[model samples]
Target: MASRRHPLATFFHLFFRVSAILTYLCCDWFSSSFVGCFVTVLLLLSLDFWSVKNVTGRVLAGLRWWNQIDEDGKSHWIFEARKVPASNMAATEAEARIFWLGLIICPMIWIVFFFSTLFSLKLKWLALVIAGISLQAANLYGYILCKMGGDGDISRVTSSFLPQTVFQTACPDDFQKPGLEGLEIHQH
Candidate 1:
């Protein structure tokens, strides 16, 4: 059986996504200053982005991405792919759904806000909302690519990455030593 996310992790994952929307709406009730409202929304949006990328993503989905500067000063993204068994694929899919759904929906809410402010000639608030939309969209793109690349299923890299000893131990019955006969283990 696949391990489930902690209750608190799940709560915060949903909370942060929803709070971003709620904060923007509620800011009006608290103050009339456009700058104050813009800053407040920006802070909440940042919190949502941070929580989704760092806490919820790692805890719920077992996925993470980071950029590293190599010795030659070239930057590259290093992704961590958690080894999940076939049985846990469904759970992983569910987590991915939540993550992607939030990514799609949050920016949409901001888009609506953006146009409303634009039409009203609220340039200051529009600027901040545009920034929020851009940040969310970038996050969405990165996560989608990461999910596609790091899906826990076996691929060309999996065979090369898994050592023969461990593979044999894990699949003793069907194990075939590499470079012997024409046997190849192809996982679907």
Candidate 2:
């Protein structure tokens, strides 16, 4: 199931992730200003986060995630996979594999960096390291949920606490919510 259509998204999916890693690994060689390196790495990470959550996952893996607030003002995390028909062009195996690999691997690298920074007592870099870990880990976790529930199981998971209209309005027509028939609304 390899796809050739999303080469550009695949490129950027890995580009920002790899760039952030390289920048962190060789920050000293690239610049003398701690602020410069810190800002640069954060920017790359932010781009990677946005691209993965909003663009690459949707294009390459048919996955998208977001947080929504219900009328009760409660927050809900929605993980969605695009509805694709059998005859449509599904994501290729290669691109999907690359998306998942990049999603999973980057956070592990940041975790290792976290411990290394802690052990070395480089507290100055701790904040930056934590930021990287948080951002990467968030995408990883959301995608995992999105993929796990790709078959519309998310409706089941979220329907208990949320109103049926929430999913309907939040996703509109792009996503598939197969099990919505069984949802029951609870009043506070």
Q: Assess candidate 2 and give its TM-score to the true structure.
A: 0.75
Worst 10 residues of 2 by lDDT: 179-188
lDDT of model 2 at position 34: 95
User: Model 2 segments beyond 4 Å from truth?
Assistant: 1-3, 83-91, 150-188
- Cα displacement (Å) at residue 75, model 2: 1.2
**Number of the top-ranking candidate, with TM-score as the measure:** 2
lDDT of 2 by residue, 73-143 (tens): 99777766665444443444456657777887789899999999999998999999999999998887677
lDDT of 1 by residue, 91-123 (tens): 554564465556666788889989988999967
Report the lDDT of model 2 for residue 121.
94
Which pairs clash (backbone N, Cα, C closer than 3 Å) in model 2? 1-92, 1-93, 2-92, 2-93, 3-92
RMSD of each: 11.2, 9.4
